[model samples]
Target: MSLVNLEAVHKRFGEFEVLSNINLSVSEGEIVAIIGRSGSGKSTLLRCINGLEPVQQGRITVDGTEVTAANADLNNLRQRVGMVFQSYNLFPHLSVERNVTLALKVVRKTPYAEARDIAHEVITKVGLADKFGAYPDELSGGQQQRVAIARSLAMGPKVMLFDEITSALDPELVGEVLRVLEALAADGMTMLLVTHEMKFAKTVGNRTVFMHEGRIHEEGDSRETLEHPRTPELTGFLDAVLH
Candidate 1:
């Protein structure tokens, strides 16, 4: 069964529609990369799925739970859905360990020792085992992004949503964060990401979705869809981005 499913979803800002009649399904462990222009609704789509944005129409479900239900527990839904953003939203004064454990300790009321252990495991998973004691400012942008990823991982979410997480990094540092995603992909973590990294999307994505003017313009196997785009819009987009 699909873990994430959206049917005829719609979202708008005043008269401007951000998402339009969207339908999508993602199975367990699948990696889907959403690529489009700035206003194409990629980020909004993720937000809607995670309940960060409210949709005007359609149903959304994650792991058989109806996210669109009137009384849906958004806070509880968020526990199953982890999101990482363009900015590493770590607390500057907190060590990586503390930053990762904060939600566990405060929100979930996990014991400090238990939270610390979870933090250690996820930090190590992101290859930051040696930097747990470091503060955010002390680490490189890439390392901080990794910490952000580790923090989300520590939540033990069923799915992860990444909103251009590497966009804020220096070009040279982008690879490190992408590598962490690659590792996560290898470990069968279901992920959906909005990204401008064409190569990474093709490499790590099982499917690639091209959105244009709040609609899915094209979607197919990552490598084939990216390499042999069937639509003028996708072709133009690839041409613009690649060259």
Candidate 2:
């Protein structure tokens, strides 16, 4: 069974349809990448999955829990779905350790010491053990984003949603962030990434989905989708971006 399934998903921002007739499924331990032009609803779809943006029609299910319903327990759902954004949204005032531990302590009611230990473990996994006491501004963009990922992992989420997480970084900083994500993918973390990193998408993703005009234009094995694109839209896009 699919870990996430969307059926006829639609979204509108005051009658301007943002997503139309979207249907997609992602299985557990799969890394799926969504690629499209800027306004093609790629980020909106991710937002909808995370409950950051409400869906106007159709259904979205994560681990079989419906996200489109008005009565869905958003807080509960959010805990299972962790998100990383283009900008690493770290709390400037908090140390890296505190940032990672905050959700555990506040939402899960974990004791402070226990949360701190858990935070340390995750930060270590992200290769930031020595920077635990550092603040966001003190770290490089790559380091800060790693902390952000560690924070999300500390939540023990079942799925991770990345919305152009490396788009804002310097060219030199991009690889470090991608390496962290690659490690996560290797560890079988179910991920849905909206990215312009074609190399990573083609190499790391189990599947690649092409979105155009707010709908899925095509989807298939990453190798085939990137190499022998079935749609004219996809062929044009890969040409413009890759060549």
lDDT of 2 by residue, 185-209 (tens): 9999999999999999999999999
What is the C-alpha local distance difference test score of candidate 2? 0.93
List model 1 lDDT by residue over 125-205, tens digit each. Answer: 999999999999999999999999999898899999999999999999998899999999999999999999999999999
The TM-score measured for candidate 2 stands at 0.98
> Where does model 2 exceed 4 Å of error?
none
With candidate 1 superimposed using the best TM-score fit, by how many Å does residue 43's alpha carbon deviate from the native?
Answer: 0.6
Report residue 175 deviation for candidate 1 (angstroms): 0.9
**Cα TM-score of candidate 1:** 0.97
What shift in Å separates residue 37 of candidate 1 from its native position after superposition?
0.8
Q: Rate the local accuracy (lDDT) of all candidates.
A: 0.94, 0.93
Give TM-scores for every candidate, taking all chains together and pairing residue i with residue i. Answer: 0.97, 0.98
After aligning candidate 2 to the native by TM-score, how far in Å is the CA of 93 from where it should be?
Answer: 1.3
| Distance from true location, Cα of 238 in model 1, Å | 0.3
